[model samples]
Target: MSHQPDERQLSLNAFLHDTGHHEASWRHPESGAERIGDIAWFQDIARKVEAAKLDAVFLADGPAWWGTGHRPSNNFEPITLLTALATVTERIGLISTASTTFYEPFNLARLFASLDRISGGRAGWNIVTTFSEDAAYNFGLDGVPSHEERYARAQDFIDVVTKLWDSWEDDALVVDRESGDYVDTSKVHAIDHVGPYLKVRGPFSAPRTPQGRPVYVQAGSSNEGRAFAARNAEAIFTAHQTIEDARAFYDDIKSKARALGRNPDHVKVRPGISPFIADTTAEAEELSQYFNRLTVPAYGLTQLEKMAGTSLRHLELDERVPVEVFGGAGNVLDNNRSRRQVVANIVERDRPTLRELLHRLAGGRGHNVVAGTPVQVADTIQEWFEGGAADGFNVMPPLYPQLLDAFTGQVVPILQDRGLFRTEYAGTTLREHYGLPRPDSQYADEPALAVGT
Candidate 1:
């Protein structure tokens, strides 16, 4: 008998930024930058996503400000910000970025565990190894650690954090009224992890959370990144400009996981998608162009400088970028290690002038930017899903409220009708939302099997 495909398996996440995905989204007349500091703004967005039953609302973070201070400099801290957001929304998953390189494993573990309990099991941790040298300076480091060193530290960080999370067994918490015992001491264990980069001593103060541990999400796509995620990540956020690239990444990662004795389906690969929608294809195209035109060339050039890791101050706005300027993107890919290859690929393929390149990078750094009517946008999403290129997507609106409203109002309903998206939330926790199992504590003892001699 042929196995039937699972129909209720599409996963969708809203990738929340200061204003939106477009670099110049804040400058859009309808967009609101006034409330970037307001919790209510994010709360309202989260509520809308919950109403649509999105799997999660993700927040990208960096330790230091990479952009010019002229716009909105990096504003809020993610963990504290998400804690506030959790109180206002009911069901949508909360995923926040925390760099493994910058934080202590025990503290990071405690924060996420607390968040999971506070949010009633709707927390997820987006694991990232810090990349920016600016971030290194902020952390009081002389220079950024090598990519290999960062990933090595990351592996140990995850190991220690997982140990901390597992320190308190599921049954460890026992509020015995008569005995006045809050916890069974025998059931709790300490993890004495002493790796090269981390030396964390456990049992954590927090008990086992609602989901055992927060769902682990990863975003890096380098070889080291892929290996790390294959070994540990439950869901992966990736960037891809084409179906072929997405498929290749998905297949490679899943295959790697299977080779490591993991269930490949457990590692969901979702790419970033920024869609500009309108009543018609022409109108949508015009809207996308309008956003591109609104982009400040100076701001774009500065961003390009950061990506190219060289000064572009002397270059004219309309001049062509030299092919040799990038220094071949080091072994692991330079600039932003995660995106340098992408930028290089774009430059090598298109050979566009500096002005044109600025426009191209304006839409969320090479993520697939689609401009079309609701039907067209939905068709593209459906195609990517059905074609096995993506499990779903990280929806990036070009601008807030207006862009999100357009997508949630117009495109979401179409997806719901087609059975490509959920009409109502079926699960309470982030793990459930992604169809991932709550990981059992590695410290738990297993019963021995009886066998005949």
Candidate 2:
């Protein structure tokens, strides 16, 4: 595929993890697990990401520890870590996953607002609802809320947070030192929001943030999640194994956005890509296998059990898992969109062995994992970008620093040469970098606005 003179270049974000996305990445010799807790290591990586001119850097977080100590479960909190990262990186966006279920609207709003200001309009929030029972227990809840109930809470949670973000008009902070009149009280508004789940009162302490509000990013593929994202999310992070599914998801989300009377193009759809790069295709394929060889089957099975919500003790590791085995998640898969459906799709299509399934997942969880030369990797990206399967790809490296180096130092140059990605940043803010407009405040400029409540 070739880009026309006026055609747009796709976006790319660095989906960085403590070691990497691979389950055994920490065990890899090239991984930076030795300094995973050091802030300087992340800072250095952020600098490299900026030098590559990426759209953003994202970190996935959970309220409670993830997994049962199979890997590096204790990770630095995304918002907190990105706040420190903000001090070092100048142009790239800082996106973090925050749970709407665990944090109050007021506190979450302030955290993002502060980050946006400190980063000079580079903050993006990946909104999520806490689903783990362990997370719920930490918050003193008896049990996790039902899927519908948590989503209901998430809807109100987002509404409340945005209301607070928009409580102050763009021109509310008028620091007229001579007149001793520092604030325009008339311009400020108190978003007296009373929703089914939350109640918040009065104007926010801070003024309107840079980029109006940090770009609303969400990651969910379930029906309720799609509806919520269609109305609110400016960017979506989704997962899929094939181009057909990716295209279908892209169309579904965009169509939903259009039906909501929002511009579909404004909502960029990016699917995850876990790439293993080498000079030659053969070498790259072997590189993936090398990492797969390092995987711990016990850990993978435990994770698989979590994903399928059923024990797989009866199945042999080396044997190919029957399609009926995933009928195991029959009811569970219907409700949960991400986990159970991924490998089931693989089984129906390629029928990989049970151990092979673990190996594949050990790469990027459920993301598309490819091992090839930089040119081939760029070709894969271009085909998807041009064929309407994606607006961009979330670059998730299996073995970080080493794999990240290969992607940026090797693959990114190829993408730049093909005119598939940008070589230099053209904007200062995350919204601008994403080709999204800085939104008007909830009650600014426009006199009659239907604020969500």
Candidate 3:
């Protein structure tokens, strides 16, 4: 009920992957694959996204090498890369994913604060409890922690970071040379936090930010992930291949947040979508086919194995994906929940053969894939937004620059003309873009305690 009918402006984020979201995008003749690691390439794309009046530019990242194969993997670290893009763009929000499992609270808190300052308040944090065995090895662990254990650590981690961010009150900084006093030390307070997972002592290193804290963006969709997002996230990035599924998730997350005493409207649900656009429907289909043809079956099988948490290399590509191979993740509380859900949906809906499934997932991982003319693409997007399936979408172009150019140049105009999308940015800060309020420091009422005293 908190999602009022009158407020219906679409919220879009340009989810920037290397060359594109398509697994074989780098192999495409039109993509700018060679310059995947180039900062200028990212800046160029960010500028394009900003020009379209999109809400933000999001970068998805993980610490480990994604897979040993032909597909182009994400190269740059997200926070640092987004920080660099922030210097060039004025209004677009900069969001980056960082794992709670691999990072300490204080360090991650400081980094986000620095980015918020650098971007003039347009900053967001995509909190992820990573689920990679290789990532654990990278951080000197013998094996990955259990799902419940990771989320437990994540909850504690977020608490510590929030306290650290709130350490310096808004009025603490009083730069007055006339009085020869740089700051109001009396206003700064220490958050002496002690928890099961971490003990972070503060007065923090950074001062209060323009937004108080970076906008919290969550992408997990498991039961625990849903609860966490309900309690904390202002925005959610999710993957669902159908309108029915998306609408269900949108309703569930909002209702959960409302039950938790949070405003449902404060939590925006935006699903990832990769559109193949062209002048004609037939042309668009051909373009999608071109990308699908380029997909490597081996790579898809490998990625699928990772998703289902089972080996499928022995299965023939022509055979239908067996439901039994997953060992029934439908009711399990602690499997690769998101990916398993994707495979389950695919199985239930179409029962695709392994070859067909690879092509189906080639575009946006588990997110929706649509191929059509600009008008058709706009229609699909509008339907989802109006149908309560999405607040907006994470616009993932299959091939960078060219595909992105088409979306911005062609599809975006249709959305704007239909009055479903914005023509220009309404606000400067990321919170404002997402219609979220800026938070006050939590330590505002507490007495100051100087460091080391």
Candidate 4:
């Protein structure tokens, strides 16, 4: 399976998590949980991913610890860690998740801009309206804001941030030692934005980045999330249980972008995939089962309760999961839609017992999980890309170093050989890597007629 010179190439991002994505990943013998706090460990992962020619390295984060304390949760601040990783890696994009609900637009914009500058234009922001109630409590809120309210705030927040990013024009800097004119005042303007969710008066402190601005990425998958992503996102991260479902989501989001007069191709859809790979399918399955055996069922049940927004601890482990807990497929939630559907899909499709359901979702939470030989894993990735289910994927390894090495060493070569993925770095900046155009500053140029006439 090979394509001609001009065929579309896939985009891949290595999602960085301590140890790996499986809930029990830290328990695996090969996983180095002791090195979780070491920046060198993350840098090594970034370097390896860059060597594979993947598009980027994504770090997921939130304000509060999310797990049941049975495993290590997110510790590193994404932007800070990516900034350090940027120092070691050159070509790979650095994407950091920052919550719209938690950060002030100006502050968040500055951090992303700083990262973009530090990384030499290889920066991206994964916009998220945080869903964790624990996170809300950390902010001293009485309760989590309603989903509608959060999205509304997010819209205003992004508007302000984008304006701040565009506050300085490309030619604003004129570092002439002769006349000592450091900046051109005419090219810089204050946004003076006053919105429902944010108030900012600015010209950003930072200058324009090489890509003009950091690439805008989104990760929510609800109806409102789809609308937001369609209107503004350059790339999106999502989760799905099957190829058909992923295709449905991809088509729907692209259609939405088209209806909004946005370039559909500019909005790349990347679903997360957690692969447990080995030389043989049986060995891969065994490897996966080993991780499942290490899983703490009480922790999994607690997590399920949080996802479903209902209690399940009383249910017998051997009995099938309660479908009514999800409010059925049609009634699936809009706030945490992806996870809700994952729970519902498990109940309706497999009708698995509570214990079985936990095992199934142990790797990726809600994303597709495949345990197979390297070729089998590559086959699934290729099928998803060619079949319109994904532009690529947020590759989540089940265990760090081991699975990451297997994928980059084994699976990526197959993709490169098939002409589905790139063998060498095509571009340096994140925007170029994603095939997105660098946006002209919103402050650029006057009307053609006004200028000429």
Error in Å for residue 229 of model 2 = 1.4
Per-residue lDDT of model 1, residues 208-308, tens digit only? 89999999999998888888999999999998777877787888889999999999989999999999999999999999999998898888888887777
Report lDDT per candidate.
0.84, 0.86, 0.88, 0.88
Query: lDDT tens digits, residues 1-453, model 2?
Result: 556534577999999888888889999886888899899988988998999999999988878876566798755878889999999889999999999889989999999999999999999999998678888888999888887888899999998988888888888799999989888777777787899999988568899888889999998877777887899999999878888888988888899999999999999999999998898999999989999999889999988877776788898987887888667332212435555677677776778888999998999888899999988888999889989999998999887788888889988988887777887889999998999998877687645323323
- Model 1 clash pairs? none
Per-prediction TM-score to the true structure, in the order listed: 0.93, 0.95, 0.96, 0.96
Judge candidate 2 against the unseen true structure and give its global Cα lDDT, from 0 to 1: 0.86
Candidate 4 residues lying further than 4 Å off, grouped into runs, are 1-5, 330-336, 446-453
What lDDT does candidate 1 reach at residue 382?
84
Name the 10 consecutive residues with the lowest summed lDDT in model 1.
444-453
Looking at model 3, the pairs that clash are: none
Residue 242, model 2: Cα distance from true site in angstroms: 0.6
Q: Between prediction 1 and prediction 4, which has the larger lDDT?
A: 4
